[model samples]
Target: MDKFTTLTGVAAPMPLVNIDTDMIIPKQFLKTIKRSGLGKNLFDELRYEADGTEKPEFVLNQPAYRNAEIIIAGDNFGCGSSREHAPWALLDFGVRCVISTSFADIFYNNCFKNGILPIALPQDVVDTLMEDAGRGSNARLTIDLEGMKVVTSDGTEFPFELDPFRRHCLLNGLDDIGLTMEKADSIRGFEEQMATARPWI
Candidate 1:
């Protein structure tokens, strides 16, 4: 996981609601436990044709959105199955933050763990950001996690709420394993004591 203090980059507008985990990476691509290389398969059904060619009509295939780092999406984003691959693909594709009116609970939690910032704002706020994202390459959005603000290219700022604990983890690049590693000394000590107390086992 990478630290996510601040990010300023292209924002792609995805207004479709109920973008499930399967849509993000598709079921066929879920066989691998590895997180890398999934970006190419991200939105496989929508981004690629049945012949495995790029879909020109897809938002991600558009030249302006090809390198989009932020996503302004519709309500109920990340709905459906709880597969963690969705966030992995998005992160690999360079999306550091996602701004939506709402998100599914499991997916929202997974984003934090995977170093992706999933922001929930009011519908009006999302609408404004979505419009800004539509301005093409000239319009860039800034997401400052420490400041909890998303600033549009035109200088409009919108504040969003995030759990303090999740914010701390992302700022420090700490995933579940990272969090455990933070208490390495204590864990080691506990193991030693257990070994000595139960030598027969």
Candidate 2:
């Protein structure tokens, strides 16, 4: 996991609500447990046609948003199935943050575990950011996690709330495994003590 302190980059506007996990990476691409190679297929159905050609009308297909590092989406973002691949696909596609009015519980947690920040802001605030993101590549949004605020290109700032523990984990680049590793010394000490006490066994 990568430490997420502050991120400044292009933000693509996706106003569609109820964006389920399947729509993110599609079920066909879920055969592999690996997180890499899924970026190319992120939003596959929306990005391509039946012939597998690029869809020009899609927001991600646009030149300006092709390399967007953040996504400002509609309400109920990351709804439906609880597949962890959704966040993996998003992170692999260079999307380090996602801002929306609301998000599904499972997907929101998964985002943090995968080093992607999923922010839930009020609808009005999201609308403003969405408009800001419409400025193509010219506008770049900055998210300061330590400061707990999102700054627009024009200097407007919106504060968001996040769990303190999650913030700590992201700041230190600690995943579940990383958290466990933090207690390695204590674990080893405990094991040694147990061996001495149970020598006969």
Candidate 3:
């Protein structure tokens, strides 16, 4: 997991609603437990054709958005299925933050665990970011997690709400495993005590 204090980068505009997990990485690519290789297949169906050719129309495939680090998306983003691979694909593809009017509950939670920031903002605010993203790669957006605000290239700033605990986790690059590791000494002590007290077992 990577610490996400602040990010300023290209933002791709994806206005499609109900973008399910399968659409993100597709079902075929879900066989692997490893998270690294999925970036090439992120939005596989939308990015590539039946013959494995690139689709020019998709936002990610476009030249300007190819390296986008942020995504300004439509309402109901990340709907359907609870596969964790969805966020893995997004992260691998260099999307550190996603701004949307709404998101599916499971996916939203998953984003925080995977080091991806899923921001829920009002529809009007999302619309503004989407339009800024529409300006292409040159119009980079700035997201300051510590400040809890998203700023457009033109200097407009919008505040967003986030759970304090989740914010702490991301700032420290603490995933579930990372959180557990933070209490390594306590865990070791507990195991040692258990072994001595239950000698037979």
Candidate 4:
């Protein structure tokens, strides 16, 4: 996981609602536990045609949004299965942040754990951001996690709410394993004591 203090980059507009986990990476690509290779398959069905050619109509296929670091999507984003691969695919594709009117609970939680910021804003606010993201390569949006603000290219700012603990974790690049490592000394001490007390085992 990487620290996500702040980010400024192109935001691709994906107004489709109910973007499920399977749609994100597709079940065929979920065989591997590794997270790195999924970027190429992110939204595989939508991004490619049956012949495996890039779909020109897809937002991510467009030249301007090919390298987008953020996604502004419609309501009920990430709404299906609880597979963690969805966030992995998004992060691997360089999407550090996602702004939507709403999101599925499991997917939203997974995003934070994977170092992706899933922001849930009001519908009107999301609509504004979606429009802003329509500006092709100029759709640069800035997300300041410490400030809890999303700033548009035109300077409009929208404040969003997030759990304090999640914010802390992301700011310091602490995933579940990283959180456990924070108490490394204590864990090591406990193991040593156990070994000493149970030499026979």
Candidate 5:
């Protein structure tokens, strides 16, 4: 996981709602446990035709959105299965943040764990951001994680809420494993004491 202090980059507008985990990375691509290389398959069905060629009509295939780092999507984003691979694919695709009117609980949490910021704002706020993202190359949005705010290219700013602990973890690049490693000394001490107390085992 990478630290997500601040990010300023292109934002792609995805107005479709109910973008499930499978859509983020189709079921066929879920066979592997590795997180890398899934980006190529992100939105596989929508990004490619049956022949496996890039779909020119897809938002991601457009030249301006090819490198989009932020996504402004419609309501009910990330709804459906609880596969953690969704966030992995998005992160691998260089999407550091996703702004939507709402998101499925499991997917929202997964995004935080994977170093991707899933922001749930009011519908009006999301609509504004979505419009801002329609500007193609000029859709530069700034995500200030520490500041808990998103700034549009035109200088409009909107504050968002986040759990303090999740905020802390992202700022320090701490995932579940990283959180455990933070108490390495304590864990080692506990193990040593257990061994000494139960010598037979």
Candidate 6:
């Protein structure tokens, strides 16, 4: 997972509320354990027509938002089934951060595990950011983890809160496996001691 320090990119506006996990990647695309290659299928149902053509009306399908790396989404985003693939798909699609007024708790934590920042701001602030996002690709937003704030293109800033442990994890690129790996020396010592104490067993 990439370390999330400071990210500056175009923010796509998605004001549709209650965007569930199924909407994020759809259940049909959940067969693969691998994280790569899901970007094309992300928002599959919304992004494509029945004939597999791109839907021009979709925010991501629009010319200016085609490469959006940040999303200012509606309330209760990521609110359904606890599919880890939702974050995987978002990450694959280059969306490193999602700002919403609120989020589902499970989905919120999953975002951190996969290196995507899920920001929850007041409705007023999110509304303002969504407007800024619609200002086109040049209105890039900057997320500064070290600074604990989101900066609009014009330098307007909104501070946010995150658990210290999660902040540490994102800053250091430490996933569950990475945290366990850091205890390798202690783990090895414990195994060695166990082996010596019970050779027959």
lDDT of each: 0.93, 0.96, 0.93, 0.93, 0.93, 0.96
Give the Cα-based TM-score of candidate 3 against the true structure: 0.97
- Candidate 3, residues 23-83, lDDT tens digits: the string is 9888888899987989999989999999999999999889999999998888898999999
Cα-lDDT of candidate 4: 0.93
Rate residue 107 of model 4 by lDDT.
96
Candidate 4 C-alpha lDDT tens digits along 57-134: 999999999999999998898988999999999988989999998899999999989999999999999999999999
Candidate 5 lDDT over residue span 10-88, tens digit each:
9999999998888998899989999899999999999999999999999999999999999999888898999999999
In model 5, residue pairs whose N, Cα or C atoms come closer than 3 Å (at least 3 residues apart or on different chains), thus clashing, are none
Q: Which stretches of candidate 2 lie above 4 Å from their native place? A: none
Clash pairs, model 4 backbone: none
TM-score of each: 0.96, 0.98, 0.97, 0.96, 0.97, 0.98
Assess candidate 1 and give its TM-score to the true structure.
0.96
Decreasing TM-score order of the candidates: 2, 6, 5, 3, 4, 1
Which tens-of-lDDT digit does each residue in 146-181 have in candidate 6? 999999999999999999999999999999999999
Segments of candidate 3 deviating more than 4 angstroms:
none
Pairwise TM-score winner, candidates 1 and 6: 6
In candidate 2, what are the lDDT values of residues 1-201, reduced to their tens digit?
A: 999999999999999999999999899999999989899999999999999999999999999999999999999999999999999999999999999999999999999899999999999999999999999999999999999999999999999999999999999999999999999999999999989999876
Residue 98 in model 1: shift from native, Å? 0.9
True-structure lDDT of candidate 5: 0.93
Q: What C-alpha root-mean-square deviation, in Å, does candidate 1 show against the real structure?
A: 1.1
Which TM-score value belongs to model 5?
Answer: 0.97
lDDT of 2 at 96: 95
